[model samples]
Target chain A: MAYSGFRLIREALTGHKGWKPAWRDPEPQAHYDVVVVGGGGHGLATAHYLAKNFGKTRIAVLEKGWIGGGNVGRNTTIIRSNYLLPGNEPFYELSLQLWEGLEQDLNYNAMVSQRGIMNLFHTDAQRDAFRRRGNSMILHGSDAELLDREGVKREAPFLNFDNARFPIKGALMHRRGGTVRHDAVAWGYARSADRYGVDIIQNCEVTGFKIENGKIRGVETSRGTIGAEKVGVAVAGSSGKVMSYAGLRLPIESHVLQAFVSEGLKPMIPGVITFGAGHFYVSQSDKGGLVFGGDIDGYNTYAQRGNLPVVEDVCEGGMAIMPMIGRTRLLRMWGGIMDMSMDGSPIIDRTPIEGLYFNGGWCYGGFKATPASGLTFAHLLATGGPHATAEALRFDRFEKGLMIDEKGAGAQPNLH
Target chain B: MIIPHPLLGPRDAQEFVYLGDASLLDRPDWQHPEAGSAYYEYLYLRDNPAGVHRELWFHEQGDRSWLVVTRDTTTHEILSAELASQVALSKEPVR
Candidate 1:
């Protein structure tokens, strides 16, 4: 049912008996026109756009676990498009645009809080880099502002502004960037896709791809062998393992990136604040908990848990910037496997195998790029060509020496 | 995780830079006919085993020496560690 204020009052007056499930737990069919793997935000949103925008039916999204069980629910929920690269800026800017109208579009409360995001700069060189990045954002029709130490103090006074080692010199502010309720994005997309007759089959693990004559036909799953004319794999961290089942090794590495939340407190953080000298970035959740994270555990692994040293390191980075966080008790912490591509960017293109497609290598940027990744992926799957905004995100970019090395970290996945 | 360094007594894993799979040391000849595919496989494809794995770790903050570390990925247990230069010299010469 389409949710509305009138509907809420009617339901309240009628004892809420007319409520229904948001999405159906439909059984997997024997065949489908298209199959989208992984039911995280990207997968669900892909299916939603495929049905809504592309007018494709008989689509199914197969998930090994329940929706929002992956990085979708395990991220810091920050979103931004303040990128310096041409290949990245437009795509992420489109995601921010989609996020702006997401709630109204899906008729779901996603809590897209565009409170703003500030990247604190500590040194003169760092300030110049951010100035260039802010200029790039403005060039791409996105909002950005270069703020000095005084401006940063006005925005977030709790930071350790006078830290001897890494004093806050300035910041690059993107007013359109903020956080969203991560899981609600999955729920909203899943519900909308289901409304369009797209089957969402959970607990269906794809064991292998049923390819014959070097072309795709369907997939072999734990449930059964389901046939599909086209298959799209959007499994984030499992990209390497899943694609290997089809005898295709991706240019990706799986690493665990951990995130943390502290005990709830009164609202203190004005917006998301990223440490200049370190990897720490934090924002206050609507629930009053401080949601934060740092770098990925520097190893290749599919595990969803991190060790103590990284935890200590992340806390150190947090304390380096905002010393007040040193007193806060960490409520909970978890890790999500990152599909770290060599160039620190993502790939949204068709794979070498005919009728098979891949959408992964998101690293730390996956959650923020959900809407546009889905929209562009849907465009690719439907049209058999890369979307205009995602033309550079091809698997062959590395071989062609056209790597979109956003971080300029070279070809090292760990460094990215 | 604590990695027992060969030269240094013991060091936290945080102090070292992890580069997965010691097989990266086996660089194929760039003059080979299949060098393109060889470099592709060398740079991208990884074994990513769940059990015992021999990986490379650079002592970035300490001796600055690279170590060949064999550890259990499933349990994070360090089996052994050695100087990567020594391990490279001891390996079968590259073609």
Candidate 2:
């Protein structure tokens, strides 16, 4: 049912007996026109846009576990488009624009909070770099502002501004960037897609792909063998393992990126604040808990858990910027396997195998790019060409020496 | 995790830079006819084993020496650590 304020009141007056499930759990069909592997935000959003925008009817999204059980549910929930590269700025800007109207479009309360995001700069060189980045953002029709030390103090006064080693010089602020309710995004897309005649089958694990003579056919799953004319794989961290079943090796590595939340307290952080010298970023949730994370564990693994040293290192980075964080007790912590590409960017392209497509290598930017990723993947699947905004994200970019090295960290997955 | 360095005693894993799969050190000869494909396999293809693994770690903070570390990935247990230079020298055949 479409939710509304009047519906809430009516249900309350009627003793709440008219409510129904948000989305139905449907059984998978023996054959479909398109099958999307993995039911995270990207896959569900792909299905939603495919049915709503592309007018494709026979579609199914198969998930090994329940919805919102992957990286979509385990993230810091921050969103932004303040990128410096031409290949990246336009795509992420489109994602931010999609996020702006997401709640109204889905008729679900995804809590797209555009409070703001500030990247703190500590040195003169860093400030210049941020200045260039902010200029790039403005050039791409995205908002950005360079704030001085006093301006940063006005925005967030709790920061250790006068640290002897790494002083807080200024910040780059993007007013349109903020956090969202991560899991709600997956649920909203799933519900909308289901309403448009898309089947969402949960607990159906894809064991292998049924290929014939180097062309796509269907998939072998735990439930049974299902036939599909086209299949799209959007399994975030399992990209490497899943694509191997199709005899395709991915240029991706799976690493565990941990996130943490602290005990609830009074509202302190007004917006997201990222440390300039280290890999620490934090934002306060509506529940008053401080949600934060740092760099991925520097190794290749599919495990969704991390060790204690990285935890200590993340806390150190937090304490380096905001010393008061030492007092708050860590409530809980978890990990998500990141599909880290070589050049610290993502790939949304067709694989060598016909009828098989891949959408992964998100690293730390997956959660923010959900809507645009889905839309672009849908465009690619429908038209058999890359979307205008995602033309540069190709599988052959590395071989062609057109790598979108956003971080300039070279071809190292862990460094990204 | 604490990696017991052969020369520097116990060192935290944070100070070291991680490069996957110590097998990367064995570079294939460029003059070979299949060098192009071999280099591609060396750079992109990796055996991501879920159990025991031998990897490369650079001790950037303490000694600035690259170490070959053998460890169990599932348990995060360090089996052994050695200087990469020594390991490379040991791999060379005597004329």
Candidate 3:
């Protein structure tokens, strides 16, 4: 399949005529049906779905940078519905289903790979946890396998058997989980949404929201003030500040998550392996480099730079799992800021602010949830109620003490 | 010492070190003991072969690193190896 995400973006950067729409009306518009902030994946998807499902075609997606320049372009690109939580599982499952049909839906190939994701378990307690997680997925109509020690060896024989340390045991495998070309997914949505008549305005930063009598009228942007009946805050990392300008405080924290890639080698790993006991996960990209990541930088900061300890720790994990990789040199690393919610799940709902909608608090799993998130967030925007699966992600759930804590572990104050 | 399972190929006992039972690895800071186990498991395969062949005793208690003395399981042939070179720490006895 043609991975034209970079190609399209390059075309836009070269001052392509079709890069943006010329405003027929130079002055501020009286009102638009909808205005979306942040032309990243979620914003574009929202505009696309809004037009497709709700007949709301008069929409504007204002981006501060080039489209998809945010976390949409910076993620590790893993996609799966292996969640065991209540609200997260079904919504992600819908996303996985959409991902399977994305090529046909958008007429664009995203290079979606269902190569599987395996979570290794070292202790009996961890194994038991995996068993429960597997069972949970099965109960929810998703595929999950609980592999024993011999099964683990069969799946990944390269693992070290004994030295004087942690033993090789079993793993929980989600065969439907895999990766996609992240930038392609974004560009596919942008192009498809543009075809649907959604105006994608680049270099347009939302300076402040225009509200009157407790209802949002539109947004004032760097380009110019645009009027809209409804406004959606789809900005992920910059969400808090955007909503703050509207006099709203959200339960969201911004943190940086780092990902690393090693120099290209012949493909050694065919699937994703997550170190459940340790804070690391790795997979080999089609380009032959070993791609991996770890937990978010514990501190609260928007700077997309991480400390060296996490990088070293994640690399050490790769070497421990596959000894041959110790010889591979790391090429480069980058970080993306994430908007982590208190409950570690996304919040996509109508806020208390009249005519203002939100789709933030994606944590690290937003890439996988793009399709379903857009579909459902649009549903709420048009109908004023959440899509069935997104009911738990409402902003009111936090105050009502009804957080959908899927990890079972209490929300990590340090984590999202 | 029998090779653990189907995944591991049968090599001469001379390739290993017997450091004794896994005791030195029983700490939380060396990373959760489970992590230690996973690390050592990978170490056995990647490290260059040394010590006696058959019967290896691993001693993990002293400095949290393994000390293996390898000997042939059948003939008790002592192999040429020591614990000094495998780890960064010294195995010298402290007064």
What is each predicted model's overall lDDT from 0 to 1?
0.90, 0.89, 0.72
Misplaced by over 4 Å in model 3 are A1-30, A161-165, A408-416, B1-95
Q: List the residue pairs that clash in candidate 1.
A: none
**For candidate 2, what is the lDDT?**
0.89
DockQ for each candidate?
Answer: 0.50, 0.40, 0.01
lDDT of 2 at A71: 87
The segments of candidate 1 whose C-alpha lies over 4 angstroms from its true place after superposition are A410-416, B4-11, B49-52, B60-65, B72-75, B79-90
The local lDDT score (0 to 100) that residue A15 gets in candidate 3 is: 79
lDDT of 2 at A210: 94
What DockQ class does candidate 2 belong to?
acceptable
| Stretches > 4 Å off in candidate 2 | A410-416, B2-12, B33-37, B45-53, B59-95
Q: Output the lDDT of residue A29, model 3.
A: 49
TM-score of chain B in each prediction: 0.96, 0.93, 0.26
Write model 3 residue lDDT over A1-416, tens digit each, in one string: 23357867877798765445322212334567988888888888888889988888788788888887989888888988788777778888888888888887887778899999888878888888788878878887789998887887777777764523456678898999999998888888887887787788888799999889999888989877889889989988777668878877666656678998889988668788888556778888999988889887543445677667668777776666667777788898998877766678789988777999999989888889999989998998888888998888888665555777776422134222
RMSD of 2: 2.6
